[model samples]
Target: MQELAEVRLTAWVHGHVQGVGFRWWTRSRALELGLTGYAANKPDGRVEVVAQGPRAACEKLLELLQSGNTPGRVDNVVAEFSEPGDALSGFVER
Candidate 1:
């Protein structure tokens, strides 16, 4: 038998993410999915989200992030998949 591997999803959400409650929404979704990581705003006018956990959960979160939660107008989602850093205790908004 084989076990599923952990994954990390790093995403940069563009368009109306800042000042629109994106970070808090991200933290809520991530926590619901049982992912551990953080969400923060970049000076470049994007929202950075890092989620580490089961691959399926991470993928689902990615989809939600791209779907533009309430109060956010997500125009584009630039995402990347990589190995988890294994350093997150819980989902947070930074």
Candidate 2:
């Protein structure tokens, strides 16, 4: 059987993500999904996130980013594969 490979992904969330408890919600969901990463607001008015975990888990994370638990406007999502690293121990607002 083929083993599931761990993947690191960088997601750029654009829209109204700040001041809406988006980081907290993202942290909670990432932790629940067994994903390790961090979410922060970029200087250019975008939410930047780096997540690392199993492929399936990462996919779920992307899905969550697209459709938040409550409701938020996400203009676009720019994601790319990244190299794994210890960026965050827990979800944090930055």
Q: Estimate candidate 2's alpha-carbon lDDT, on a 0 to 1 scale.
A: 0.80
Provide the TM-score for each candidate, comma-separated. Answer: 0.92, 0.85
Give the per-residue Cα lDDT of candidate 1 at 10.
Answer: 97
lDDT score at residue 55, model 1, on the 0-100 scale: 88
How far is 2's C-alpha from truth in model 2 (Å)? 5.9
The true-structure Cα RMSD of candidate 2 reads: 2.0
What TM-score should be assigned to candidate 2?
0.85
Show where candidate 2 strays beyond 4 Å.
Answer: 1-3, 68-71
lDDT of 1 at 65: 80
User: Which candidate's lDDT is highest?
Assistant: 1
Q: Give one digit per residue, the lDDT tens place, for model 2 in 41-76.
A: 888878898888877788888988887452467888
